[model samples]
Target: MGERLFLGVDGGQSHTEAVVADERGRIRGRGRGGPANHAEQPGGRERLARAVGESVGAALREAGLATEVSEVEFDAAHCAMTGGADFKEEVIRSIVRARRLSIGHDAPAALAGATGGEPGIVVIAGTGSVAYGENGLDRSAQAGGWGYLLGDEGSGYWIAMEGLRCALRAVDGVGDSTELGTRALRHFDLKDFRELARAVYAGRIDRDRLATFAIEVERAAREGDASARRIIAEAAMWLCRLVIAVAKRLSVESVKVAAVGGAFRSLSLREEFAQRVAQHLPLARVIAPRFDPAVGALLLAYGAAGVDLTEEILSNLEKESGR
Candidate 1:
């Protein structure tokens, strides 16, 4: 008989990633595809299917397991996505065949990856932001992740929007002068704030596109722009609040906390966030994630199949994946 195979997928707002692993917890292959969120929108189900199929198919091919068949069977498959999993089971089943399947929110997968399914918190700040944690008591809690229109405080979108607001205020001579104005104008290739305002109002730029401006904001902060620094500081505070809220709910005195996502790529922002978290939760330790969310999903897949995740397996995974 062929060797048993397992699959793990992280379907996020920015993109979808899949990993194929063997029974011994060694990563065989990995693949990436387009975003796989909003499964309830028009054409959403098709998009999700395509994203999953594209990523998983590539992984299977890389693993030397792809055949002429459209559907690949797996011993177990676990998918963790940005939105809740309630609406995606049927769509996923149509794309892949698995003996054991588990689908749920992306937070748990992220947490599991960050903490190795131990007890801790993971703060994910991408286009949006959220903090999720477990306390080893079969209890878990989450904070933030309200999306752009609602909260998403300390997220890339929030930081970019705050930078733009500061630029507008500065241009109008109502706020502190900073380099954000020139940076913003140049980043968007706009002649002036008038053009910027019109483009945004006309829906020419979506949240994801706008959220990328946080990079410019981060650069400005690094260059010592006071307004930019303040924005980042505020963002750090907001993110810290998320950690504190989860910690309080979990009622843990000490826990391992890892910050994940693109926004945390900024060293300045990461330092600020670490400082803030330390200030509030002195007992909580901020550490690097042992693996990314995709690997986290893979860990969950192992759990779903009743596989024992021993030290040898984890060491093999870390050695193979370079996590």
Candidate 2:
């Protein structure tokens, strides 16, 4: 037998990421691809299969290994993909059946990455938003993730929607004026409110694209747009609420909150969210994730292989991730 290796995947609505690691939890390779939301995409099953195969193949190639390597040489493979769909499970089962791989959900992979395989809360705020945390014995709970329509508050979609609403209100003189109105108009290439309204009502502004407008809101806020700032502040508050809710559910006095996604990357937004969370959960510690979700996936792979991850293993993985 050569040596056993493990694989971890973070399959999300926006993108799919994979990582390969050795028994010691040291990342050896990685790969990434586009969205894998099986519930929404056409031919979602095929897309998921291709994404999983391509990502895993890339990692294996990077590690100078073959898919058909000796079974005794590989420890295990696991994946965490988004969309709790029956089709997703079917797709995962197909992949595992074909390659003898193991798989899981994207949330647990993110949790593993955030807490160094320990128990902690993870807030994901990309195209959508969700908060997850684990207790002893691997018991876990999740909040939010109601999607963009019913919930997904504090998400990129929510922020963009609020920004558009602010713009529309300003146009109607129902809200304070903001540069966001003009900026958003330009972003969508609309000359006026009438056209913007038509586009929104027609479902022309998809969540992925609307999320791009969030940057405009951020810019306007920086430029002293009162409405933009208010919207951002409100979004931060919603995110903080989720953290508090998760902490209370777990009954942790000082929960570690790891913020992930493009939205939380903004220092201003992170600071605002941290402040709000601290106000409610006084002992909560809101911090940036030490490693990316893909690295977390790698940790998950190692765990599935029955490897106990120590601080040294995590440190090595962090160093490899350039953290």
Candidate 3:
């Protein structure tokens, strides 16, 4: 007889977020926790479980619903994770109970959030990069998202790795000499290339840690470093290719494209991406996201539970969540 409660979660390489909402589509609470990317890695399942428990538990408490994540029962729930859903579903089921559940990769959730479930494409550049689009006809397509080893061309990790490579090349006196070398040494708190190499080879600098340097690269570009500017331009070009590929595959003359994630935090990058999309696809428009991926998962939860969300309800969600 209590009010119907819904749940949404966005699990990414950098962090995990949980949102609690009421039947009227107003955000009740929000919570955050550490990363939950690869469930097949060592202790991945346990890490995923703990992340879910922590984020959900915090959200439930904030909503004044339950003290523990296990104590709360949801009418419906949706989870969108960086890694695929197959392995995560089992781990999630062991932690929380929901009458209806939907689980998938983060791309669709991001698209839903970007366009509010309408037909559109979303280009996400976080620790990794991917582009996904829907045609509103149950047809969808994706580009990139190959991860760090093979792809992730426009991602934060990629940008940072490129910066490091440029710096190393400068050290060898074979590449463009720029501020990246001095900046990287200061950023990593190392005295020289030998120390930097030692930290990297010893696994002291992991993928996420390296990705944090992308922001510094952006700083270098803003400060008028030619090599850094080229890196940014190239990253923008690669990301635009993703958008164009999705648009062509969907065969849509016009579509809204939204950029999401940490890499877009740089105004320079966002402007570059928007400009590239405009040049390549004149009909395509780059728009700001109406909601973050977590709320997009909540929207999917509402759909799965047969809840018809009105504009008023969505407005409440937007206003209350401050999105």
Candidate 4:
């Protein structure tokens, strides 16, 4: 009859988050760290171990938990990590070894959060993009997320790359001119396309760093810039296509679809994406996530511990979210 604690960790490419909750799903603590995408960073295992420790330790401290809390008191922990299939097992094992917690991919945790642990589809568009669909069973299929070089269409990196392409084209007089060219030059402190190209080619710029241009593209679109507008439209269309594809694959007509990621934080893009989804798949219901992915991770943790989240637990979660 001792108090039980659960932990959820969302290990993302841009950032990592951890949440601690009681058995009743009331959040008691939280922690965060930088860039837990093991596939991208060198010393991946070690970094993940450190991140899990730091995040969980911080959450425990915040929750006023004693350092000597028994493993039995710690009912369960879940980790949602991002990466390709090749890295999935390694990531899970690393997390399990580091935290002694149950772990799953970030996608399922996100999906669970989006649908409140129900079956649905989720499209994540952050540093990367991917569509994941889950039926009533454990079955799920993913589309895209092949990585920056191979795929990840409709993601922040994709949008930023397209923006840069448009900027370069404008500079070369091969496409409609855009302020993006000037903005790109100024943003990167480059004198011209040659300088930008040299820097990019020399690997001076990383994927996430280049993806920072996406916000500029969003701004330009809001200001009626044709090139930026077109890019956003294309990105929206691509993401909608993924949603449709996942829906068809799962054969779950009208399943709830949740949008998750930093890119979706842009109001214009979110509206555009919702419109596109409605237009193409009229039966599907696209919604903003009910909670942050980290919270979703927490839900998964509860499930892993055989703790069924009651309406009271969900209400507490909502209150914590200020919803």
Candidate 5:
């Protein structure tokens, strides 16, 4: 084997992550770049190519240096993106030359990263939200990934919007004055709604900025704000429902679930999600992910190369990640 290189890329709404690893699953380099929501983005073809190039190129360079090689050859490339189904393969094929290139949705990438390619479920809540599940038989199902307008009930965007909605309600005298309002004010660093309305009407703030306020909602909830607590609880409930829906679709009595993405980083939210899911579906087990989504994409590459993620190899990967 002449330095077999496998590339895995996770193209997400917020950012793209790429990892370069050897055939043995030893991670050599990791890199990040811009969003790769290719299907919906204007100039999506070029944008997707640029983001994937930047991230994967950086990782490839790092790996090359580690192995004392001036250039590295890619044997396989596996990519998972938010709008992966619609991603034009030519965009990827134009950038990197590999013997084989595989592409799919980001959800399964998250699930594989969370469950180490085992049969399980992965729920993502970041700029967007989605739920993906795979049973032991390799059968799969998904729920709650209909974009922001239709659903995404438990996603970071939803929580941020809820925070803003509640604040607007308070301002309009329809809801109680709670810390959510204060938190929103502080999040934007504005003194009053006049500044907020002016900025919004002027198109000064965008949807991404709105989603950034979700941290404030979590913070206010931590400080015992009732409205904030309720918002977070509702988010948790929505997320839990995704798990139940997937389980029912899979027709499995029990399945391990992995909570992935920035949303589950909150302990309170994570614990609350577990509690709520158990109330309805006792077999839904929520566990921390073994690796990040990009790495999950890398593992998928390993599978394509006929490499099994054996316990020993998994252990080595864990040690490489220092987790």
Candidate 6:
């Protein structure tokens, strides 16, 4: 028969990515677009549609296939979107006609990517935080995907929020002083925390920008701010709890855990997560991702198409993806 092809997409809060590959695990093209978590805010649906459209279209163009996303030809297409985007599949199915199509929240893709489609746990702490895992026996569980308003504990957004609170506390003379407060002032170009009121009232920053402040927290922790260190440690504990809970649910004592996203930038956070995981789940080990989330989605699509990837193909995928 003719060459077989597949498409994988990862749609997150900050960006959306699409990859086109052949059955041989050779990447044909890749594309990226704006944030895809549009349903949560005003005029988001349109943005989501555009992001998906742009990414898919760019990928198709790169592959020398049809540049129009709706008309691009592929045997199967799979997508992993932000948690709130349950309807992402419907939107995608309406755009392109593939023999097979699948869509779901982002965690599974990270899990699949981290474990190379094997059963394992994956914790993501980017703009948001969540953990998911599965066993070979079809037993799976997900935890900590709550949005910012409620949960997402240990996420970059959460870290930034924690740092801001710590900074505020330091300024209030009720808590230990920390470099984080000065960092916050610098971030907003203000003289002090009291000046933060003007920016907040004027919409000078939003969720994405707020999450970026997590880096300052990481820096502060690295620079030996005890309060910053505590915040980072607490974040690690929160993430560790997610893995611990997932392992408990699956009844698996020994499992490989993978860390993903921006919150892991701090050495303290990673080491603390590993240490806590060790103390709590002695048999589990935290490891780096073998493939990125997009490839993981592609692997899922391949499975959906009834293709079991051989080790040769897996090796080729890893080699070509440069991950």
Among the numbered candidates, top TM-score falls to 3
Q: Please identify model 1 stretches exceeding 4 Å from their true place.
A: 67-71
Model 3: per-residue Cα lDDT over 1-323, one tens digit each: 87899999999998999999999988889999889888888999988998888898899888888998878789999999897747788899988799997788899989888887688999999999999999989789999999999999999999999999999999999999989999999999999989998998899988999999999899999999998999999999999999999999999868999999999997789999999999999999899999999998888888899988678768888898897
Give the lDDT of residue 319 in candidate 2: 77
User: Residue-wise lDDT of candidate 5 within 102-167, one digit each (tens)?
Assistant: 888899888888888898988898878888899879689999888888898878888888888888
* Of 3 and 4, the candidate ranking higher by lDDT: 3
Give the least accurate 10-residue stretch of model 6, judged by summed lDDT: 83-92
lDDT of each: 0.89, 0.76, 0.91, 0.81, 0.82, 0.86
Top candidate on lDDT is 3
User: Which ranges of candidate 5 are over 4 A from the true structure?
Assistant: 65-71, 85-87, 201-203
- Candidate 6 C-alpha lDDT tens digits along 181-217: 8899898688866568667657777788889889999
Provide the global lDDT of candidate 2 against the true structure. Answer: 0.76
Model 2: per-residue Cα lDDT over 138-257, one tens digit each = 468888888888888878878888999888888889988777888988998988888877887788876688888888887888788898888889888888788777778888867788
lDDT tens digits, residues 1-323, model 4? Answer: 66777777898887788888877778888877777775545787667666666676677777777442232246677788887345545654543332336667889889988888888899999999999989878678888788888888889988999999999888789999999988888778888888888899889987888988899889888998999999998888888888888888888887899999988867778999999888888888987688788889889888876778789888888777555
TM-score per candidate, chains pooled: 0.97, 0.90, 0.98, 0.91, 0.94, 0.95
The TM-score of predicted model 4 comes to: 0.91
User: Candidate 4, overall lDDT?
Assistant: 0.81
- lDDT (10s digit) by residue, model 1, range 170-242: 9999999989989988998989999999999899977788889999999999999999999999999999999
lDDT of 3: 0.91
Ranking by TM-score: 3, 1, 6, 5, 4, 2
